[model samples]
Target chain A: MNSAHSDIDRVPMQLVQGCLVASVQVELSPEVLHVFQQDLLEAVRRTRARATVLDLSGVSILDSRDFRSIERTLEMASLLGAQPLLVGIRPGIAASLSELGAQCAGFAAFSTLERALEHLDSAG
Target chain B: MIELGTMQIRDEEAPVQIRVKVLGLLVSLGADEVLATRVATAASELSHRYQLLGAESRCRCVLHNEYSSLLVEFRFTSAHPHPETTDLEGIAGVMRMGRNGTGTDELVVQIKLPMPRDGLSKRAIARGRERILQRSRRELMDELRAKNAELEAYNETLEETVAERTRELTHANEQMARDLSAGSEYVQGLIPDPIEEPVRVDWRYIPSSSLGGDTIGYHWIDDDHLALYLIDVTGHGLDSALLAVTVMNVLRAGSLAGVDMVDPDRVLFALNNSFQAHHHGMKFFTIWYGVYQPSTRELVWSGGGHHPSILISPGTEAPAMLEATGPLIGAVEDMDFPAERCTVAPGSRMAIFSDGVFEIIRDNDLVWTWEGLVEFVDTLRGAKVPLADALLQEAERIKGDASFDDDVSIIEAVFP
Candidate 1:
């Protein structure tokens, strides 16, 4: 689904088992990221998912602003009664995130979708 | 003998008519071409100014033979008298202020020329008089032709000089470009080869067209401690690259006297003290320095206004970003870089890169953010592609046909 701005497409949000999985594949502008955050939180509330896995394997680069947005999204997801897990950070992206000082210390992280699912499953 | 001519100034054409009458009288008096033109121009200016007073103005010219001198006098009268004759300072040969018999304010400007000598015989005098009248017309035509030739020569010289200066400038610019290209090559050669050891180090470096300031290197401080760093100077070009190379050399040699190379904080502190921003043409740099001890699987790191190193452990989904612990190097005096430690598991990967690695503009004019880089790298997790190749390919894909705006440098170390 398209957001209010026709230029930005919606992030794919799926209800997998008891978790909400949002695969963010496209390059996110600040405006698009804002829309995605709101949509993800709304989806979590509607599905009543206990956990959410944010797949960032498609994101190859991030700036400081985008990093801050992801941090806020994680915080908001937790506030909405869902444990947010960031998964599949590529090596280059991981290096860049560290370089930008986006420690992402507020949420849990998994290297792969399977690992993230297993961790969430065990925790649940 | 005296010849008198009078002209009334009623309109703008009055000055032109007065100049023609004065020039004819001067030429008849056998005056030189230069002197005749000067007197004609001065008479024209005076008549024009006198007409501006808006009164009945009349110009009277009298050519008379006075002893051995031929005197030409131009007298102008205006009903509205203006005694301000200072405007005639550099114009007329002599300006006599007097009143006519009717008591009108009159200005008389006289131009005197030397007459033919009295020693000349009657026959020579007659011939001289005839020659003066005949050659005067031809002389005026010759003077006009000479002036036009002078102007044409001056224009040609000006064009030639402009062309010569343009050629010199083009040559200088081309030489400078060649020197810069050679200098950039030398700087690229300064980067050390990759290390294939307990910690396999692989790096990718692409200098921007303007030669940006990015230098990365890793060296073994001892059998146990391995020091790795990435330094980004404030700008591009020779100066920034030179500063980067200087910092790299010092790091490579572990040459900071009395500072422990294994300690990231101490090393950065010494570097800050050594390369003060004020001393280096006000240039400053950001640096990420880390000392890894394979024995303990621990990395002690510190940064000066630099992005943190990403530590991706084995079996971990999210990589940890190690951020800067201090301000930029050479920017401030007495700055401290506190060291932080993180455990690096076997089969884990750590990447230290400059901001240029991810600060790319996409074809759509949007920046390829760090999030995009992360997602792209995640897809290569199990793939056999090297980290540097993967990053370069992804960057190219994101950038499309556009070249990088800054130098991109990356150092990826895999612990087997």
Candidate 2:
């Protein structure tokens, strides 16, 4: 915890007119992932949001377990009744994740944040 | 005219006393401190210049009150050689120096000034002489003490400055220690917990007492396949730690592109291509990666400039060395790392370690090489402590301390 000050900084969360967006940065360490889960869920419950987007545009490198944790967090957000959408998965990462046989079939992923927001708005 | 003073300028202190007497005489004649000091400066300069010639000179002061002006004269005579007196004019305003005779060493320096409102009298001249004679030795000692006090104050200031700088340096050292310890803890956290269900696995890693990067871990690539890896970056500190972390993450997650996640050879090849030395500050790393299958009890392993691991079991008479040689990852691209496979017999034990474990100085001041380490591992039969812990303890004991110069890392897995 002492040397992890900079890494433990909060995941940037924004509430966009009833939709919550949590931006993910690089270095998906376990401590950061834990904080990410706590921060995203707390933000979702507090806002009573209709849509939730976990932005992965900033992240270029992720491991298998970190990917699993991200997907599981998204699922939990859906259970809380918010429509969860993952946006901006890098093409290189997408290819590697698919090759590694990670379960990405159930995730609602989009190529861009704009497309994800449009889908969420249309669904409402 | 009144004869103010006369004394032989015998040494350095005489000229100083002469100058003061001249100042007292001027002040007694109704001159202010500034006027008195100006005359005193002239007297002091003339006496000092004559003293430097190493000649015994006699100085006499005479004051004269004329119609509207007063004259102060210093008459000097030396039995030995004398210095030229032309520069005396600059020191004494309205003053001039002249030789008493063409072939003699006698010279007279005279300064002319406006007479005071009141004419000079015997009473005033007598008062100046009495006060001059009354100046005692204690007053001189008091003056010296004042100067010494000033020097002591400056010395105290210097001592305080040194103390402040020392405190700042100590603080910086403490900060560095805290940061390094925190980094060590974080890297240690990257290792996955020991496996219990399929096989009993444990490890010991002591990062260089300072901060160096040495990483080891075992994780399941899938339900049936388990992946294990150990990495040693070339250098130490922050860059090495970051590279170690990134590499371990890529290996544990099987996150490299076109990498058949279960194949040890493909993983090494991909890592070599992705992290060529030129792209990474010319840094290289050694790695031992293996994939273990529980159903078959077979381990597929590859190496890149890393030490070979050891496999020993109750049934085998001799310990088997699992050796795989390839160019160091990031050293040569397109390196074809040969994969080696070995089936684990029942109750077999596999041991893997970083170079720091074996490359240590013993009590005989000789380095224990890989062969020596292999021989030592072969003898650890029925040891009270587990093999991994025993190896670490032995390494520390041989080195005479736990603070190794390199990161000491060892992983031992007992097959079910």
- Note the DockQ of each predicted structure: 0.00, 0.00
Number of the top TM-score candidate = 2
Which consecutive 10 residues in model 1 chain B have the weakest lDDT in total?
B129-138
Deviation from native of the Cα of residue B389 in model 2, angstroms:
1.6
**Interface root-mean-square deviation (Å) of every model:** 37.2, 41.8
Q: What TM-score would you give candidate 1 relative to the actual structure?
A: 0.51
lDDT of 1: 0.77
Q: Work out the TM-score per prediction.
A: 0.51, 0.53
Q: B104-180 in candidate 1: lDDT tens per residue?
A: 77788888888756532356334433432333222455687799889889989989999999999999988877876
Clashes of 1: 27
lDDT, model 1, position B42: 63
**Cα lDDT of model 1 by residue, A91-122, tens digit:** 64564345434677788888988898899878
